[model samples]
Target chain A: MLSDLYIPGASALHRMRPAWKLALLFLYCTALFVVSHSLMLGLGLLLIALGYGIAGLRPRHAFDAVRPALYVLVIIFAAQLWLEDLAMAAFVTLRLIALLMAAALVTYTTKASEFTDGILALLSRAPKWLPKDKIALAISLVWRFIPMIRDQFEEVREAQRARGIERSLLALVAPLVVRVLKSADEIAEAIEARSLD
Target chain B: MTTRDIVLIALFAALTAVMAVFPPVTLPLLPVPITAQSLGIMLAGGILGAKRGALSIILLLVLVAIGLPLLSGGRGGLSVFFGPTAGFLAGWVAAAFTIGWMTEKFWDGLSFVSATLICVAGGIVVMYALGIPGISLMADVPLSKAFMGSVTFIPGDIVKALIAAAVMVTVKKSYPIIGQAA
Candidate 1:
């Protein structure tokens, strides 16, 4: 859903290690929490965008990535307008967009396997008494499951539409729930077969 | 737990624990501040699905319920459950369920990015619904006010959702087998 905004390409940004990218991503996000403003944040956002461009992404691709979350951007904009002033709200909204875009740029270029491995490497740094393998497995599993959910959602939607149940949350939510439960079993079996146990 | 397993679990706990302690934010307009905790929820739900995700939260909540101050403000205890953010806190389970189910059902085509969107949609929407109402009732504020306060989170939440969804999609695109969601 969110990742589609990625400009499909290879570049220096894309070639960076996932661990390094994630660290940069984290630090960049943290910077947003601190002071987000005209030059600093704008420049930050711009650099990130430039990185995306250098990675061969077009304007349309960036738009596509943030398009899904547009509603959220609007809502937050509204909240800012309501709670504070138009200026503050606008500033915050722009800052957020920039930060998320930067983050997405990193995601857009990085490979999933490396991303998962990067997270696992991060997890392995924990003190004694933590389930590093499970955490890594969980991260990998979630990443793997994304496409499955999208595919199932379309199938269920089509199935429901065919059944003439238009816009029923049940039609959507129920199958989703069932499919998830079933997947769990399949995953466990796979894991067992692989002897991850 | 075996020595290695113990080491691994600690690692997982540490990630979440560190996140809990970081306490980053976008704004202070609302009393119930927005933190990266939702990202934690997304990660937990996206990665662990139901049982494991639920377990991760429970482990964190246990520390909170026992007065470990494991929440955003370093404030925790059973009392925290009754506070304004409780609904959002409690929403973690349902959110996980929603993400897990969505990812499980459609694990083949949607991509980890899209699955992340599902996870975040359920996680945040349900979280706020619960959090707002819980906060209203607990703080003696009008429900509408509580709802308004939550407005500040919409943009960030949406961004989080998109990121989660996008990441999921990308992953699924690469390793097709990772789709077993729930």
Candidate 2:
């Protein structure tokens, strides 16, 4: 569930280089803060909607991008209303929505590998002790292990549940950590055997 | 770092992400849901020691920056770096480092009480030192108001600290790894 975020598309946004898309996203977010007017933010939302459409994504995609942030946005909205005025509340909320949508659009279109490569390229100019290759390996390993660990957690939870254990943090985590560490040992040995380092 | 160290770091980073999969405990008054992911921060530092523990969190944040949706509620991307939570995100790295440092310092006679204190120092104290100001700046609220609002998270975070201390002690006895690793 980690890196399968790229939705298949043949649109211009999809075809654009990952680095450029990321840069533009950065610029858009910076500009969102610089321009405080709600009208401009509304226009920015329209542009993001147009972006989703141009990328052949549906309205649902835009909604999905903003949905995770709805709670925080609501809280901010309420806080702003209490602290300031109704207009300020709407402005702050709209600004965050615009930022989330623009950023989500890039992730929806860019492949994980392409994104990683783009990041690595950006880091290529860093000092030598950084160990770029090792960092890359670590990233790939993280991607590989996220789902595996999720599965392990579920399995452990199920086993514990069968034993009439429920909602015990130590009971759940103790076994999960042990199993995960055990697998980490095996993975390390495998990497050593292959001399992947 | 050794292969084992690298793998341990990656595995812990994965653990942190998996922690986010659990449903957050929400309070009606507060906007942020209390999530399990921060417990992973304490565990990493307590288990992996200072260097590798901090590296693992930095690695996770890097992935988040590139838009993996690894955070709770599937929120990620460059935008998160600019969000109200950005300071807490930065604090995670520092917190892990602090916890690891304290754990290693007390490894010779590490107790549950000491471990819990370490988690509280790093996870709650250090985290809020950065996070409160972040909320203050991003939400355009005063520092005092931000600090007042953040009081709700402390009890939950203390619970996390206690749980992390227990897990750390168990792991240390069952499969010691902090100083054992190359």
Candidate 3:
């Protein structure tokens, strides 16, 4: 499920260095906060939408990016309208939409490996005692384990359901945690055996 | 940290991410959905102790910042850090740390009541303390209003804390991990 997020493309946004795109994203988000005018925020939203087109991503893709935040945005809009004025509500909503769209564009264009490399480049400047290699390993291991754990969770859920135990939180979680911990111990031993530390 | 420590940190981070994959339990009156992800935070700290527990959350956030769709409802990326709920997300780190520290301190006489108290202190008090201000700042709402909006979440969070406490006590008895390693 995680792997399917990145759309393959050779567009300019895709070709740009991950580090530069990340820096621009930071600047864009900060700039959106600074420019409070509604007109400017609307223009920023338009620009980000156009970015999706330039990246060879469909309009649906752009919508997908902001879809998850739709609930929160709507609630904020209603709250701001109640608390302040219509203009203020529109301003806050538009600003958040623009920020979400811009960030999504970056994710749509960049690959996970490229993002990890850019992060490593940034972390390289940290203190030597930070164990950069170990940090990288830890991040990769997290990526690896996410799907594994999700599958394990599914397996445990199925097993519990078969036992006619539905809607019990403890029944679902306790076995999963026990299995995860047991697997983790084996994983640690395997990593040690390989001298990966 | 030992290799096992690093692995445990990664595993806990993965566990948290997995929790987000479950559909959130939505209530008719509440604006926000109740999520299982916070329960994962409590478990991480109670089982892994202070340092590794906190580190696991940091690692999870780093992945989120890099645009992994790890958060509930498949939301992630740099924008999440700027969202209205960003404060709650940030607070998870401290929440885990507080729970881990307190659990360790109470390890000698840890009980369901004590564990639940620790989870409430960290998961609810500390989380809302940071989260309310974040909503005020980002949504441009008054602090009092922000606090009012968040009141809907307390009952759900308390339930999560109870579940976390039960799970921790059970795990500690069956296969203890916290303070077992340096």
Candidate 4:
């Protein structure tokens, strides 16, 4: 599910260089916080939605992209409501949603290979004493492991549910750790066998 | 570090990121949701030792900064770094380092109880110390209110701490990932 967000399309964004897409994301993220007026933020949200459209995405794509963040957004809005006024809540919410949508537009349009390549390129230029290759490998491993772990968690939960036991972290965590460590051992063995180091 | 060290670091870092994918348990009153990622943080510290555990956490944050939706609830990117949750996210690094360092110091003699104590100190106390101020500043809330609100996290974190300790002891008994101090 982690990599499934990128819908394949030949939109101009998909055609743009990965570096340029990343640069645009950076610029938009920075610019949104700098211009925090409600009107500007509202316009930014509209612009980002338009960006999704240009990237051959429908309004539904934008909503789906933003949906995961809705829980956090509601909490922030509620907190702001308690502390400040509706305008402040609205401003913060819009600012966040705009920034998130802009990022998602890039994410949903960019291919995984391009994104990984961009990351590798960026890390290659890091100062000496940092293990850039190792970092890059770790990033790729993160992507690979996310869905695997999600699946493992679901399976563990299902087994526990079938047993009719109470849903508890204690019941779920130990087996998950054992499985994760075993998989890590296998991954390490594979890397060592490949002598990729 | 050898190739083995690098692999362990990467594996634990990936574990931490994967831990975030679990659905969060949200308490209705508190803004912060209870998550299992902090348990992963404590386990990384206890299992991987000090420097390696901290490095793993830094690696995870680096990925988050680069716009991977690796955080719980699929939140990521630099925008999250500037949001109300930034402090807690930053605290992950410190918490991991503190717990790992303590675990390393007492590596041979540490029991599950003491390891759990370290987790609470680092993962809960240190995290709140950083996170409360972060909310007060970033979210524009009062420190008193933020501290009061964050109390809800304590019970959840205590559970995570105990679970992390139990996992570490069990894994050590079985697989023994961390080497003995020379």
Candidate 5:
């Protein structure tokens, strides 16, 4: 369920430093809000889509990145359509899609290790006694276990469905918690054994 | 904190991220969709207590800050903070902390009903307190409209709170040490 957007490639975007990619993302997002016209936002979306092409990424990858936000985009579109004009609704939705795709491009190109290393380098400059190692490890593990926990969730969800507790949100809770906590314990023990502390 | 605390924090952070992968239930009237992520936040606090619970969410935010698509609908990056949902994103930390703090203060004598109540107060009440402003400011909507629009989230959130409460109670009964204070 954790859709890691990193599509491995040697594109220029991938070659760029993660920190710089982040800086540019901030710049792009700021630019998105500043440019208010529908035409400009539409052009912005086109420009971003072209960037995906230059990066040797498929248009489908960009679409997949923002796919999960389809519902939210529809909501934003309908909300603006109700509250304002068609032009404004299209402007807002296009901006959101452009922004999501831009961010996704960065994630799709950059490897997790490169991103984490960049983050660690930045965090290393923080004040002393910040528990930099622990924080770094926690962040790394967040990426590592996200996919695993996602798989576990699917397993638990299927089991719940099989037991005919499909509609009861409350019923799914206990087993999911138990499984996660059990894994947490095992992971803690493994950490101790490795003397990572 | 000890190894166990660090590990539990990471695990709960992962849990929070994983919860976002579940497809959100969108109510047409509200901008914010109903997500299981908030339930994970409640569980984090109720099960892990204040310090670790808040720290867990902090770690999750750190991942988001670095542009991991870990939120519901695969959202992340600095831009997300500039979006209408930023307040609710910020509220997750506070919500988790509030539930954890409540559990720490009252969970020694925790009851099924009280646990559910704590989740409601933190998960819904505190979440809205922060989120309404977020939507109002970022989305450029009126505060009154934002508040009214957000009322749709309550029914789903209430169900989530009950689930979180029941999960906590079950965990306490099944594996008591899991929630025992570090």
Candidate 6:
């Protein structure tokens, strides 16, 4: 998810340390929480957009950040409108948008290595028994699978469509289960082969 | 650290950080926002086992502690624990331990369903236990009222549990015996 953007060349926004960038992100979010005024939240949202532009992220990338949650936000806005007022709705949505882009820009630019090293550096205070290597392996698994899961999701859909059983939960989910088991077996066997012991 | 190890750790941490930022589902009845982040927590436990899972989460929380806007709604920083979600945040550590312990406790063999249940309990129930007290104190509502409000999250929690189960199965199939040791 962090490496999806194709924007060429590193810019200053991308160059900011992940640690400092995270600090700014917190400040911006806190500002969003404090700025109850819609006009002001709107300004914050615009500022986040400017940050995105500075990071050299395309407008489409920003849309990609909010697109999945777009419908959900609409429902949330409608409910907030019913329970609260229009201004509150506007404020809430702006809060959501600003936070999303600001975070997206961070993930969009910061390399995963920076994130891990940043973490290892941070965790130096922990007890000596903690196995940092095992933790690193697990993190690698998760990172390795982000795109893999999405790809499998599509592959499942395509296979279902071909099988003419796109409508059934049994059909849709069964393959996912089967594939999962198959993958687990393969992973286990691979571990056995390497015989790290 | 090996180059490969660095890549792996970074990837999982990023996966979790992304999940943490994932927007919560808004149900009409509940004031609390639900998200898929908890499942990520469970997955951290199941796939990484306890030590690694805990470490990955520690890394994520460390980012938050240091003031990264990595939480849901783009909220982060040490101050957030003072907010409504602090309990859930703290629960991540406990939940990871529970998941790892349960998944590895099979003396007979790998009982995927049993492991899944244990992980789910850690992921859902333990979190609620921690989170409710947290919301009770932070929101300053009666414990029961705080609980009643959070009960709305059960439906979402169940979904997260099921998804965690599915993902656990995936891990078993694709990457069984996650580390070098069988």
Q: Which DockQ-derived CAPRI band holds candidate 3?
A: medium
> In model 3, what lDDT does residue B134 have?
89
Candidate 4 segments exceeding 4 Å error: A1-4, A125-128, A143-168, A182-190, B20-34, B62-69, B74-83, B179-182
lDDT of 2 by residue, A1-197 (tens): 65646789999999999888978988888787788777778788889989999999988987887777565567677788989999887777777778777888888898877878876786688789888778878988998999999999999889988988746766887888889988988999999999998
TM-score of each: 0.50, 0.91, 0.94, 0.81, 0.82, 0.53
Better of 1 and 5 by TM-score: 5
TM-score of chain A of 4: 0.76
DockQ preference between candidates 1 and 2, better one? 2
**Model 2 chain B lDDT-worst window of ten:** B23-32
Please give, for residues B1-182, the per-residue lDDT of candidate 2 as tens digits.
88788999999999998888765666566555678889899998998999999999998988887768788777776667766667899899999999999999999899999999999999999999999898777777678877877787888898889989999999999988985736
Best by TM-score: 3
| Candidate 5 per-residue C-alpha lDDT over B1-182 given as tens digits, one digit per residue, 9 for 90 to 100 | 78878888988998888888776666566656678888889998999988889999988887776657777766775446655567998899999999999987886788789999999999999989999897666555568867866776788898788889888888877876434555
Candidate numbers sorted by DockQ from highest down: 3, 2, 5, 4, 6, 1
lDDT of residue B76 for candidate 2: 74
Q: TM-score of the B chain in model 3?
A: 0.95
**10 residues in a row with least lDDT, candidate 3 chain B:** B22-31
Query: Chain A TM-score for each candidate, in the given order?
Result: 0.69, 0.90, 0.91, 0.76, 0.78, 0.70
Candidate 3 lDDT, A56-81, residue by residue in tens: 99978878877887777887898999
Write model 6 residue lDDT over B54-75, tens digit each, in one string: 7667766755554455655565
DockQ of each: 0.05, 0.60, 0.68, 0.40, 0.46, 0.11
Question: Model 4 TM-score?
Answer: 0.81
* Top lDDT hit: 3
Q: For candidate 4, give the docking quality class from DockQ.
A: acceptable
Model 6: per-residue lDDT, tens digit, A54-79?
A: 77777887776665456545655665
| Ranking, TM-score, top scorer first | 3, 2, 5, 4, 6, 1
Local accuracy of candidate 4 as per-residue lDDT tens digits, A59-102: 88767656775765776788889888999988877776776677
**Complex DockQ, candidate 3:** 0.68
Tens digits of per-residue lDDT, candidate 4, B1-182, equal 66566767776777777777666766566556778788888888888887888888888787676667677767665556655666888788888888888887777777899888989988888888898898776556678877866777788888789889888778778776665542
